[model samples]
Target: MKKYLHTGILIVILLLSGFLLWRHSVQTRVSHEVVRVADVGAIAWVPFQVGLEKGFFADEGLSISIVSVQTGDESLKALLSNSVDISLAGIIPYSFVALDHPEIQVLALNTFAKDNQIIARKDSGVSRPEDLIGKKIGYSKTTASDIGVEFFLKNHGITKGQVTLIPMKPFAMPVALATGEIDAYSSWEPNIINGKKLLDTRAILFNDVLSTYTWHGSLMANKTYIESHHSSVLAFLRAWKKSAQFTKDNPTEAIAIASAYTKIPAEALKQIWSRYDFVANPSPEEVVSILRTDLLWANLHRANPLATIPDPVTLLANINESKI
Candidate 1:
């Protein structure tokens, strides 16, 4: 009889353990799923950081892991290699690989404005594009900075041979200018802002001169991920949109977040934030127009010799702006 009792107790314990295991599995499934994002670590992605810190992503039942990279190109590479689910990058590098990777889709555009500029030392006597002749100008090769310098020179009737091009990383540009290593630099903020503060430099030209030029800061993802996890994509974008609105509504707090995450001075961010249009969704027409201009520039400079421009309309999926 005691043996029977022992057997019954063992059965009870086993049943209880099985029940608990099933309950735990259900709980795990109900919990938020992790989504990896490759971030370029640009101040333009301040909204994403704000969203993460404020529990916006949590509200969507999603947890985002941001992998920091130095450049947008690096971010794109991470996405292509399956290291991350999404990439935050500029339009140029995004376009370079867009056609090749049909799986990659630009989920949304955060900002569409002129952020690239050509800054010259106040004492360099390069107040105009013509003055850049014979001057040593520094730029990050194959980036918007380089594009700006090339476009600026061409518009002002200056040839590439006229100026000495100094290839340097974006971070080193300001110091190079201050120490007379380069007379001018083609760069974007917050480096531009920080460099100007550290030296007597002024912006001689901005990319806005090209009416067709649009500096697009975009969020992109693979189509497979978007198809399988449509709800998650919508949730991410919703959180991002809310954070962007928060930046506009609460400028002080927004700049604080930006300054802390990017290590950029709040004053500097405040000065440049106005230049960016933090829209969650950009119209297809606008994107196409921007890509058209980018393709033209790429071809003119013969940078991507093997890359043939695709029809701008075919570059992206039929993105439902409603989700964004």
Candidate 2:
């Protein structure tokens, strides 16, 4: 009787341990959905995918829901409304950030390639940046690319007064430039490649400064989300950094991933992805520079009637310390 009682107690203990472990296991599984802009399109978007495919996210105990966003503004709105966890976008988020949402920060650079450039036809007498004077140039409406293109132009002494700025998608830039409807377009590949294919269409001057500007393809997160899910964020970024590392180490596979995600061919991915530095570091000055230029453009164009970002530094999201 004594032996049987002892065995029963031992069994109960074992069963409880097993059940507790099972419960813990069930509770530990975390799955999250993330959204990015459809136009944030490129190989740079690879880290999110790498985190998914390589079991990196699982290792960090996180699952990401990567989806397409309408644009940068949409991504932030989604973040604000708690629709998604992170936004992979250009510096466009700077346009919306203020004292209201200091938590929205660029966690990592998704990609660093100058996928965008100024494409023009070989003829029609448009060559130097100054040559764009009195010519119709294509740009986007209230976008980071638009702001960047205008800054690039002004820095080169080609003001909007001299160049007619038309709004067009980077993909459609080739068509607009090819059809002679527009003189030139500031865009990125596969449109860059497509634009050049248009029977003598070429880049008069490719703005490599686009890369130099330290503009990032960012992994944006909110403060509330970070505070509640600190572990989740760390796991996500760790997986992300690993994904970034994987992108550097595995070019062929990375190209395939980039091609698959962007739907650009592997050859095109290879050409463009090679040029951009795919690091995870977020540069403060780059963000500041982009914001200052954009704010000026917003002021110059009067893009915002009543909007005022009192402190651009607030956009950087300063916490007591970096939470990596």
Question: For every candidate structure, what is the RMSD over all alpha carbons to the true structure, in angstroms?
Answer: 6.4, 4.3
Report the C-alpha lDDT of model 2 over 1-324, residue by residue, as the tens digit: 999999999999999999999988767654343322223554446766666678887776665565565345556677777777776666654455432465676555456655656766657577766677788878666555566676678678766777778877666676778778888776544556666666452545455663223344666777666677666666677777788888889888877877777666788667667666676454667667665655455555544444555456655543333455
lDDT winner: 1
Worst 10 residues of 1 by lDDT: 205-214
Per-residue alpha-carbon lDDT of candidate 1 for residues 50-101, written as tens digits (9 for 90 to 100): 8887888887778888798866778888999999998988877776666467
Instruction: Show model 1 residue runs off by greater than 4 Å.
Output: 1-30, 123-125, 200-214, 299-308, 318-320
lDDT of 2 at 80: 73
Kindly report which residue pairs in candidate 1 clash with one another: none
Candidate 2 clashing pairs? 33-65, 34-65, 36-69, 117-187
TM-score of each: 0.80, 0.75
How well does candidate 1 match the true structure in TM-score terms?
Answer: 0.80
Top TM-score hit: 1
Model 2 CA deviation exceeding 4 Å by range:
1-23, 30-39, 80-83, 96-111, 123-130, 197-214, 282-308, 318-323
